[model samples]
Target: MRTRTNGIQLLRNGERSVDKQYRGQRIFERLGNVSQAEAEDWLKQRQAAVDAQHANQLREGDEQLFAAAAAKYLTECQQRGVRTLETISYHVQILLPYIGGMRLRDVCNDSLEAFKDARVTEDGVKNITVNRSLEVVRTVLNRAARVWRTNGKPWLSTSPLIEMLDEKGQERPPRPISWGEQAGLISRLPAHLQRMVLYTVNTGARDDNVCGLRWDWEVPVPELQRSVFVIPSEHYKGKRPHVQVLNDVAWSVVQECRGMHDDYVFVYRRERVKNVEDEPVMPYDRIDTMNNTGYQAARKAAGLVGVRIHDLRHTFGQRLREAGVPEEDRALLLGHAIEGMPQHYATSTIARLVDLANSVTQTRDRTTLLRVING
Candidate 1:
C-alpha cells in the first residue's frame, strides 16, 4: 500500500520504495516500476542531505567574529553621530588591547570578569577608571547586538554577560569661603587677582567668563539702566549665550582693569604688541598665572588651608541664600537653568538683583539695632 506524506508519496519496496512520479516516469519509458519502499528510502536520503547542509552552515561561525563586528559597530556609531571621533579614539586606545582578538562567540561571563579584575589589580588602576573603560566596551558590544538584530542575524547573547563595579565616583562638594575669610584672602592677593576674585564673588560669574571677558561683548540693557556682559555661546560650557550683570563691586573692578587695555579690557605685564597675530591673545592668562602663584603664597601667609579659586563663586551663592534672596532669583543671577513651578513667575531685572544683594547687609543691621535697643 502507498500513502501521501507531506505531498510526497511514501511507499515500501523490500525495505524502501521509489516515489510514484519516479515510478511513473520509469514505466512511461518502459523501465521497471519502483516499489513503495524505494521511494520512502529516497525521501529519507533527501532529508538527510538538507540536514547535513544546515549542520555545515552551523559549523561555519564567521558572522560572530569580534574584530569585524567591532569595526562595523564603530562605523555605525560614527554614522549615527552617537559618539564623537575623540571619544571613539579613547575607547579604541584603551579597550581594544584587552579583547581585540577574541571572537564574539568566545566571550563569556568569565572572560569579562577576568578583564575587570585585571584592569584593577594587574594594571593597578583606580576602580573608577576601570569602570569607565568597561562602560565603553559594554556600550559598543550592545550597539553591535542591535545592528545584528536589524540584519536578522543571531544576537550577540552577551549583553547581559558584563557586570560593572559598584562605585559612585563623584566630585567633592564645593567648600565656600566665609565672608571674613574672603575679605582677608582678597586683601592678601595681588591687585589683578584681587579684582578677579572680587568680580567673581560679586557677580557670581564663572572663572571662564571673567577670564574671557572682552569689551566688545558688553551691552547696555535700557530697562535695567546698567551695562551687562554678554557671553557668547562658544565660550560658555552650557553652549548658550547669557547676559551677566556687573554689580557695584564688579563695575569698580572693571573700571580699574579698564586702564590696562582698551581692546582686551584686562592685561598683565603689558607685553609689547608685535603683530596682528597677537590681537586675540587672552589678557587674563598672565593675570591668572600670577594669581595662582600668589594665591598659594597668600594661603600660606594667611595660614589658611583648602582655599580654591572656585570657592569665590560658591561663596556668592551661599551669601545670596543667607541674605534671604529668593532661590529662583539666585539661580538666575548664577546663570543656572530655572526649574519647578516657580519658573513661570516674572523675570527680575539686574537692578533688582543688586538691591537683593544689598538687602542682606541692611537686614543684619536692623537685627543688630533691635538687639541693642532691647539690651
Candidate 2:
C-alpha cells in the first residue's frame, strides 16, 4: 500500500501552502494570501526555478535569500515616490549581514533583539540608531507579509512587533539663533554664503530649498512690481510649490544672487568643490554650496559655537513673533498650512504677505555684531 497525503493544501486561514517532495527530500514552502489562480501561477514559477537549477543555469540559495526581499521592498518604495526611501535603504544596509541568510519564518523577536543588542553593545551604536535599523528590518518584514507572496502564502507567518527604544535621554533641541549670533555667524561666512544666510533668515526657506533654487520658478508679481519664487512640490515638504514672498532684504539677496549663475538662484565659488572661496564657481550642482563642515568652522570662528544650520529656521520663526506678525499670516509666509486661508487667505494677498515678511527682516546694521546676546 502507498502512503496517502494531501500534499498541497489550503490552511484554515485561506492560505495555500505546499509540502511536496523535491530532489528526494520533503520541501515545505508557504505562499502568501493569493487567489487560487495566482497560487497556481506561483507554483509554475517555483517549478521553473527548479527546472533551471537542474539544467545548471541556476545557482543555489536563490530561494532562501532575505536580502532579495529587501531589495524588492526598496524597488516598491521607489516606484511609489517615497521621499524617505534613501534613509530607509541606509538603515537596511546596516541590517543586511545580521539576518540576510535566515529563512523568512526563522526571523523571530529573540533573534531580532539579539541583533539590536549586538548593535548597541558590540558596535557601540546608540539605542536610537539600533531602533532605526530595526525599523527597516520590520518594514521589510511587513512588506514581505502583506505585499510579497510566493504560492498564495505569506513569506513570514506573521510580522513580529518591533519596538523602538525610548528617547528618554537625548540631546536638547537646537537653541534659537539670536540676532547678534546670527549676524556674527553670517559675517564669518564667505560672501556668497553670507547672502544665502540672509535670504534664509528673511524667508525661512530650508537649506535644501535655498541651495536647489532655480531661476525658472520665479513668478513676477507685476501688479506689485516684485518677483516671488515658487518651489515645486517635489522639492518642498508640503507637496505644493511654496510661495516665497520676497521682502526688501530678501529681494536684495535675490538681486545679488542673480546674473552670477544662469540657472541656480544661489551660487558660490567652488575651491576643490568643498571649500570657502571667492569666485563664480558654485552652480546648481552639488559643487555650488558650502556644506555643514564649512558652516561649522565658520560658526566656531564667529564665536557662535553649538549652533546647527536648522537653528536658522527657528530664528526666523522667533523673529516673526517678535515683530508682531500675525500667526495666521506667519504660517503662510513660512510655507505652513494656514488656518483660515480658504476663508480669508486669498484676501491676504501677496502684497500683504510681503509686508509681513518685511516686518521680520533685520536691518542692515543689525547684521553687525553690535549687541550679541549671551543666550
Worst 10 contiguous positions by lDDT, candidate 1: 22-31
TM-score of each: 0.50, 0.67
Evaluated with lDDT, which candidate comes out highest? Answer: 2
- Give a tens-digit lDDT track for model 2, residues 186-236: 878877788878888888888878887889998887777778888877778
Sequence-dependent TM-score of model 1: 0.50
User: How does residue 7 of candidate 2 score in lDDT?
Assistant: 48
Candidate 1 lDDT, 1-375, residue by residue in tens:
435543243334323333333322321111135554555556666666666545443432334445555666677767765414445657566666667656666655566677777777888877767777677666666765554663465456445456767665534456666656666787887776787788888877776677668888877666655577777666665656666766677777887876566655555663455664666654543343323577788877765556566766776777777788888878767778644422222225567766775553332223233325534
> Looking at candidate 2, what is the lDDT of residue 125?
79
> Which candidate leads the pack in TM-score?
2
